[model samples]
Target: MRFFALVAASVMLLAVAAAAAEYNVVDYGARPGGRADDSAEAFLAAWAAACNDSSSPVMRVPAGTFLVSQAYFKGPCRSAAGVVLAVDGVVVAPSAVDSSAWIMFHYAHGLKIRGGTLDGNGHAYWACKSKTTPGRRCPHGTTTLDISQSRGVSVRRLTLVNSKNAHMAIFDCTDVTLRGVKMLAPRDSPNTDGVHVQLSTDVRILSATIRTGDDCVSLGPGTSDVVIRNIKCGPGHGISIGSLGGEAGEAPVRNVTVEAAELTGTQNGLRIKTWGKPHPGLVESVTFAGVTMRGVQNPIVFDQSYCPGRGNVNCPGKSSGVKISDVKFTDIQGTSATPVAVRFDCSSTNPCTGIMLNNVNLTYNGKQAKSFCKNAHVRLLPRVAPRRATAYRPALPCQLESRPEIRLVGLRLPVLCLPVLRLPVLCSCYACPSRASPSARDRAGDPTAGPAPPSRSPHLLVYTHMLVIYFQDILGCGKFKKLGLQNEEALQKCFGDIISVGNDHWSPHMVHGAAAASPSNAPNVDGNDTQDIDIDLTQDKATCEEGDTNEVEQISPVNANGKRPPRPAPPKAKKQKSGTALTIQEAVTSMATSATSYASTKQGKYSIDEVMEHVIACGATYETNEHFIASELFVKKEQREMFMTFRNNEVRFSWLTRKYMAKYGN
Candidate 1:
């Protein structure tokens, strides 16, 4: 009987509490001609007074343009169950008296600013310049809307427009959501980023349309668990991450996701900006899925020199000693400005890792694809491109602008004309230029054609849904000659050869010493050749004397697995061959182009017997002239001859030689 009574009492109390939790509606104007000013400040004050009162109703801003200067939401903003600040009205700033911002929210929880237009009324201040750091009493109409130091806040279906400064500045807030918000700024408006989210966590920005002067969205340091999804961005600096130089020793940005966005006419598509060297702050574990881009310049970019003010002598951007790691980009197809489709600049001291790309396909307007990361593990699924960039500058728009952000390759808008190259052509707008750029000739010229294929250049920025992506090309400083390729060829192969995963079996060998030539690459061809060799490697240095040759001899032509490696050269026989008279690279290239392709030639009619006789005859000739290897090594003559004769086809001969060599001491 006691338990039953207790349960009944508890149930009754809960029911009463639920019933008492109801919405209150506070209407500003009830008295005729006593209309309440619908300014942002006025609404905020009225809303605050009523929000805490248990008897206070949900404040409603009626459908009128209320001129508001600045309004702050300082309370906990714990909605009274069914109560919401429903603004089916327009809140405009005052016409004359300076206003800092239209709306500001701080230290609030469980709040939603929905269905409202916060207009800066900015015919007054869009063109005025603002410094990187504003003074204490900033001029009126500077920051349009700033929400800082808040949590569990949701601002949806709002149109925020025409601010002199940033359209929306969100700082140090967590668990915030911005859905269906349209942020609009002028194409040339200075410093007017659509949304700048800094040092925030667990934030979701979805289905927003932003056209701004600066980045559509700038994700600054210490941002974590952020998701920017399904957005339309154009006429902006695209999406940006980490101009990071100021904040070191802070928790880095991590676990960010950008997905399903369409972008056009933006300065870039995907970008990751760091300073010279890297900072202690890191950017890791980011993803870009299902992003479509059109007519964006330098769709990919990474600028390390973040803060280069007027007299920045050390302009390559400071290396903050930070590492960018474990990033992925998938399903991004678009038009980009430069030859580099994807470029990454991890500090050589603290390099990045775990970069993967599966089903990566991109088509451009005949510009080189400078895609791939240096000194990192990059996995590229099999690529199917009909054409490749044979050269870079003649194909890309690299250095056309004088941007302060060094370590970033700057691309210019509206290419003039591409001077007969192998890649796509586009009007560039990205700024990814080196500090020591000599001439503007690096900027590619315009060409009349459908957007060409992506270039093979391994160093340019890439963007997707407002996320910076590319470990594909960790391109910074490198000696092309040491890599066994000319500048352009090295750039292409540098992107093509990186391993595609973590430091696993397929990863590149990381050494303080130089990298070795890969067997999979094409042979060394003449730089001035009409037909290219398939190999991608830097040129080997000259062997001066016996000492050099001895050192070279110690290094065998085999990988770690000890596979039968392709000989770089046949030491003695090739010297006497007709090819020896030409340059070494020409000889190698001639051999490569002459090799049989699957489609070009037919299977031989000769049988196994004929091949056996040929092998025997070659062995006898080698034995007569050579002292090192003999006929015995050719496979036990009679058994090899008998077995090889009848099975002279390539497969049969190959298997017999392998089987004989395994059994005998050949």
Candidate 2:
């Protein structure tokens, strides 16, 4: 029995030794000289040797910044099926090289490059490219990290700085996982994108901090099943779907999801780009959910305008012809630059269809964003509302200051909220002259009315009108030219231009036959503001409507009045309610939904006091008290949990909802 015990103890020691994986740990400290001064190719060579030797163990480099012009990670890097090539030391490389990249991993699988820093020291490369002329190949356009044709590879917690082209590239690879990675390039740096993925599949990028001059993550054709979550992006061309197949792009990109990402100060939050040179295949099934943005330009943009400034002919499929379909954008809340937060540009003929947008909240600068589309069918759950118009910052350094121009056509209108007024209204009246424009001789006094101080020559009643693009002058009439309200002909002309008059049969803006007959509500022969005009709901159903427009016209011509009413501070209701018990205001709060519940909260009684009080009072705690006991409440397990869940979103997303509240359809 004693002999058996000794043998068992020996077996235990051997098992422990086998479980602990380690490298051979060979030392390759080079003496500072011609071949070794700036090169650590020898150390890499040693590491490779150790990895290949069945007997040699894991190889590691000591603390040092090893300079390498171009390092090729070729061969079967035997990282045992699931092991990693963990680097703790810094690897320095020339920012640009003639042929290869600083660190290139080719045909390797199941690899992980983490826990290290890579520097592309490119001072010489930058200088060499600057003093050259046009048509010359620049030298500073090399990649920092390059991986191609590998599967199940991951790069996490890695910092890549000052790269020449795209900092990191995952090419023709599958299952590329990038997490906690930081990619940086100065704001003015040229062609320096954070990470560019090409011809890859099942790529997952999460919790990455990126600031770059170009696209943060350019999905260059041949990428699908890509999932990006929890990304912080600034000063870059926010996450993109394509620069797709230039010469030979990959197959169609499908099944993409981006969630819980913040894109502050980005160019485009969610974008779908097509290749200029036409290729086959399509991009479909893309979704952007729970994304937050701040001051980003064109938060949702589908840019088919591939006109290059350098005199390239506009080509649909000839240059690059690709169509995108089956896209969904849900729960996107934030502020954008352009009024049209959600803009879609599709083919004039075979335009995109079936776009589903739900719970999208967007504000522009401080105003309501314009939601618009062309040649596409978009279904927004709640009507797109506008808060106000605000200022926007331009990208690509504008030579002239200008506001973006917006055009709307062929839109499937969403439902709008309308307020109900009390019928028993007290009547108030204002006196006005009969003539819109009095003769020059009549301006002399109302001789018959007798010494009435010339009756003030007919007060003109210059009130501002949002539709028909009308502006107001103090003389009780509009500034006709600026407001586009000069005359009946002008009003007709403006109507014709704003809405496509050519498609009069299909167009919603055409005036009814009654406008020419009743003429009372319509503008007079001379372009003048008509009083007591009723908004033709049928005519204005697809657009914004003014309270007094008798005929169909552009809804409200929004203008930014000074000193906007301060948004009501979030109610300090310490009540902890979950998802199930959301306030009606919170549920149907979209501007497009017509905010009827605004006046629900009342004095002496709660707005929802009677309706919700009994349920909440009996089931759960409505008021929040730090010392409140959870066990005291006898509500159902599911109901209590649901209330808590909803309440949490309201508080956390308070700022976000406020930003996007006004920009529903805009």
After TM-score superposition, the amount by which residue 337's alpha carbon in candidate 1 deviates from its true location, in angstroms, is: 2.9
How would you encode candidate 1's per-residue C-alpha lDDT over 1-666 as one tens digit per residue? 999999999999877765444332224432111224444445655666556745324556666566564565555554543135667766666543343344665555566777878666565554333334454333443556766666777888999877665678676678989999998878866666788776679999999999877778878666899899999998887887766544334458889899998889887787777766443668889987788878776665554444444445444444546677787777777766544566554455565566656444455565345453333335433233343322222433222121121132333222122122222222222222222232213322322222334333323432121112211111222232133223565444434442222100000000011111222322345664457567433333333444565774544566889885765764554445365556887867777776744212322332334444555433323333211122333333323333332212322222233233222211
lDDT of 1 at 186: 80
Model 1 misplaced stretches (Cα beyond 4 Å): 1-41, 54-57, 78-83, 95-101, 130-141, 314-317, 366-368, 372-376, 383-666
Per residue, candidate 2 scores C-alpha lDDT tens digits across 371-392 of 4455555543432223211111
Question: lDDT of each model, Cα atoms only?
Answer: 0.53, 0.52
Clash totals, every prediction = 89, 49
